[model samples]
Target: MGAHDAGTAGRGRGKRIVVLDYGSGNLRSAERALAHAGADVTVTADLTAAAGADGLVVPGVGAYAACMAGIEASGAGPVIAERVATGRPVLGICVGMQVLFAHGDEHGVVTKGLGLLPGGVTRLPAERLPHMGWNTVTPPAGSVLFAGLPADSRFYFVHSYGVLDRAALAEAGVRVTTAHHGTDFVAAVERGPLSAAQFHPEKSAETGALLLRNWLATVD
Candidate 1:
């Protein structure tokens, strides 16, 4: 039992999706967006609901260490890892996506992440910090998350750090979508039951809605 729970607890309402509430990220916004995408979304720290949901969404904002602290305190990290290992769908947004990596280097400190993915997160080599606002992504061919969306679809982003080691991710056989800031970095990834977005789809307007809908369609 954690602090919040959004959406209904009713049965057969829609696709059961949990927006993990580990004391970070835009829980309500994500809740509303997922529900709009036809999911019976719940924003909760309840490990049971999180582990057993049809789909699990991990949303994070702020710093990498703080988000990881919240997730660890709420005991959601192992559950997310377990779900991913068992072939259940898990989506990470923004810093949430970054924490899926091996570790993150922020402000001269390296913090351990959930380690579900191959690469680590580091500062974007862009001229500007916090690459905010809408930008188009280069989705890999046959991307499930970007499906039914145009190649030029623009998604919202707000962060200074991202996974820039495309070669490492490629070597791990991960399907990556790259978005260019100062350099090409991972935008989204779809491998097995794990998917992540460095951008905030909930705030990405129509294109974001379509992406959320695409994810919901993959839920069982």
Candidate 2:
């Protein structure tokens, strides 16, 4: 059995999770993975259903600016902010996580983010353009998202732009997780009911499943 299958042990049963459809992301894959993790999953653009769910997941792919545009066009921006303010559990994946930050600078064009988290997203200081494949992460002490996972456990990553500084987030009492591409960049972050990952857990197989299970455990 996979680590997720063994570790989750049906922990996600009965939890209602809404995968926010803002016109981006691998929606079906995320839905399937969450259901396998044991949550009753819903993929929809309906704000009411999203807001009422036990947990909310924001998934994104493609450029940072395009994802932000989708989030804005779908009218999910306010709902996401409200959910965070009300202490409801919300998870962002990939560019979904990036949009939660203050801004994203792609090439020279700067786009504003949700500002829920501090800092901006920029190209990694690496020779490679898109840092694809698997890498291990360094989760801070007391990380709920990474709890009980192996120290050397690797997660899938496929992005170039990322938040590099950990100081601002740490000062805000957010637990930061770091992984290296060319330099250390934010991998995941957890604070209160808000959590985000730079990698796609759905595509990550076992390790990703366990991470989703962990996030589900935090949902009320």
Candidate 3:
């Protein structure tokens, strides 16, 4: 076999995709989930690792401010931004996605996000503190993320703050959302080579696993 054919037979062909460790994320869980999804994931806060990655996943499970602080402090912030700018898929989960936006308004804190997305995040109405529960999404007519979904499969979610009414991102290119807090929050989004979810796919069930699997297929 040729050298190129030999290189094609492995988990992502050792194509390291840095899993940003901002100290505010569930790094191990995300790492395991990605591995299970058939991609070799490397958890790192190191700036150098970012350069080696073919794609990147910035997973987080904390306040946006704290996570941003950790990313900048670790010097992975600018690197991640650079990665995203180069058209590498940057999968951000929950708070991670929030940080990709322009800013976030949570806990009376108005902090700047990575400015990758076009907008900012806002706190949910008083009626719902944390939009916790299982909610299904119906992705728009044509979406790459839900390419093989069963048409009504539900994904797990746990969060309160959201971008806005019905959908969190207008420029996200795709629309997928879940009913929550008497409104709709972006369950997932895909724009060009980038995609993100507002829920923890690692903790989610079969549906989540499938989601990660689909995402890994986009690395090339």
lDDT (CA) per prediction = 0.88, 0.94, 0.74
On the 0 to 100 scale, the lDDT of residue 139 in model 1 is 88
Candidate numbers sorted by TM-score from highest down: 2, 1, 3
User: How much is 47 displaced in model 3, in angstroms?
Assistant: 1.6
Q: Which stretches of candidate 1 lie over 4 Å from their true place?
A: 1-13
Best prediction by lDDT: 2
RMSD of each: 6.0, 1.4, 4.8
Looking at model 3, which ten-residue stretch has the lowest summed lDDT? 2-11
**Model 1 C-alpha RMSD to native:** 6.0
With a 3 Å backbone cut-off (N, CA, C), the pairs that clash in candidate 1 are none
In model 3, the runs with Cα more than 4 Å from the true position are 1-15, 165-168, 171-179
Q: Which lDDT tens digits does candidate 3 get at residues 19-131?
A: 88768888898888777666777997777776557778888876878888887887777877777778877789888877888888888889998887767788877476687
Give candidate 2's error at residue 181 in angstroms.
Answer: 0.7
Mind giving the per-residue lDDT tens digits that candidate 2 earns over 1-220?
Answer: 6665765747889899999999999899999999989999999999999999999999999999999999999999999999999999999999999999999999899999999999999999999969999999999989999988899899998998999989999899999999999999999999999999998899998889899999988988
| Prediction 3 global C-alpha lDDT | 0.74
